[model samples]
Target: MASSTPQSVERALAMFDAVADAPGPVGAKELARRVGCSLSTAYHLLGALTARGHLTRTAQGYVPGPRVPALHRGYQRHLGVGAGVGELLVRLRRATGAQAYYTVYRGGLITVVDSTAPVSDTAEPFVPGPEIRAHATAHGKALLAGLPRPVRRRYLDEHGMARFTDRTITAADRFEAELARVRGQGFAVSVGEADPAYTCLAVALPGPRGDGSVHALSVSLATAEFRGRRGAIRGAVARAAAELVPEG
Candidate 1:
């Protein structure tokens, strides 16, 4: 059996990434331009990827296929958060009458693993995505605060706190002070830092014993409601985090 060349593998992966990054189905010429490859090469690779179920082609161009969703579901299962975690989020949403979320920090990234909201006609569902800014979100702050001091400092240095809303904390010193407060209080709260209309409260959970991973649970509500029930929301989130800890 012959081994594949590194160049071939790199080119294939580059094409795949280009397709995935596109807002919608992309044409062969556009993909070729993005990947800096010949049109023929791009078409050949696209056809191969489509045949393998990694992509699906339509009259429009190509879109992620069933395999992508299947892979994503498998990855979620591998994370081990499970249906029970979803149930807990739902319960939290009901109790607080707000959007509930479970987020994890791994490899210097904070990702919302699960959420439960939209329980009623008046409520809006919490949707998690790649666009969430870690420095401005309550759960992201909670996860960051849970990190060791040196690691936290290094992260801040690498990713300079970019401002999102007017309330976003852009100063490193101020943000560090906020993290100190979060550590002391055992939770973090954000008021219109990420988005002006929403307020969020989050509590960090202990990750696997020796691992550096940090996980947090959060509740988001309308700013008006959050302002009125801040203390109650904080207590509720703290309790929920404690309850989520695995028993020995």
Candidate 2:
């Protein structure tokens, strides 16, 4: 957000984001540190969140509350996601033994609405509104590849290709070439480019009948694990995506 945003509102939102990005339940002390707020401010903000049903206190720490899923389900419904999509994502995770992500391109940005457990230290957080460039994550790139040239150019213009690693494609011409390969290969891939420890593969899924939303299926694993079984992982994601096309 910009400087005009209220300081308390910014801190509270940042605290919530820290909780969402956390691997497990987080304590108020850690939340304060992450958001650069004082301990008392953290407690007050956490209490507000708990009272509003945005967070739940647990034996270990605080985690997402029931309101989070309710909001998420409503978002998915607006995206035209049908039943069994969550089950399909779980199955993809079981079959591939990697983190599975379900994403949709909405409001000219790619957003991950659901994801499975992480297997390692590799975290390629692609959720928009956090200053993350679309080019830094495989799912974003895959969705971008589905966009028309003029639209893609406008997106890149609005959000510059901020590099996360040396391997990331920052140049306009190079990224265009990369999108060509994604089209030819029928999938998009990131190898130690977004995050040095993670490798991701994604396949775009056609939107539902009469719906023009951009969607994709993705799996992320440690770079070392992706060494030899890349094809198998790709197939797993492809099969999952195929399962959705017929229902749409």
Candidate 3:
């Protein structure tokens, strides 16, 4: 049986979808009516999701969170850039035998927009939310490298390179150099430092605008499996990006 907390969360999720699927913003009263819940219950749920950036209020009513559209774009990026990016990730995950992730730049931070973990002993899923190391993760580095040089310097200066593991690169200059190389190679790699015995392979995806801003995707897995299949993993991610990215 599902716990009460999960049940409440599920109902809240339904309420958000009901409001979001509407043609335009929906009023709390109408939303509650549509959700078949009391007005108070509806407001409470909306307030919670809104607080967490999963929903937002508008003059018209309430709408999906900003993250929602970006997530949609990441999944469907192969078809067109408007939305549906999650579907692409699903396909990539199935093809790659590793965990796949999508991220977008938000408030100068790289937020994990979505992810899919392979069903295997080698796969270890990182709980999705805000990434602990936006500066260290392969997706984070890909996004960072796409930034202007000056902005990159400022970020490094402000967040002063912190180490996650023995192998994590913490020197600002070295990391800057690594970013330059990533830009040249068109992909990023993180080995065994972000998490012990795991490696991440990532690539920055071009957006609709010609600017450096990007949508990034990465595949992560245990070190041994990652090393054994690195070439294939890299090729799969590259192909997915080529298919999904508007510029590609």
The residue pairs that clash in candidate 1, if any, are: none
Specify the poorest-scoring 10-residue window by lDDT in model 3: 118-127
**Candidate of highest TM-score:** 1
My TM-score estimates for the predictions, one after another, are 0.78, 0.76, 0.64
Every candidate's lDDT: 0.78, 0.81, 0.75
Check candidate 2 and list the clashing pairs. none
For model 3 the TM-score comes to 0.64
| Root-mean-square deviation of candidate 3 | 10.5
Best-to-worst lDDT order:
2, 1, 3
**What does candidate 3's lDDT look like per residue over 1-248, in tens digits?**
64666656777878777875566678888878775888888888889989987788988788888777665555445423444566887888889878788776544555676678643434454534556676677887888888878887776676666788898888878898999999999999888767877889999886644433467888888889988898899999999888764543
Residue range 33-108, candidate 2, lDDT tens digits: 9889899999999999989998999989999887987887787788777778879989999999988988777666
After TM-score superposition, what is the CA distance of residue 170 in candidate 3 from its true location, in Å? 0.5
Native-referenced Cα lDDT, model 3:
0.75
Model 2 TM-score?
A: 0.76
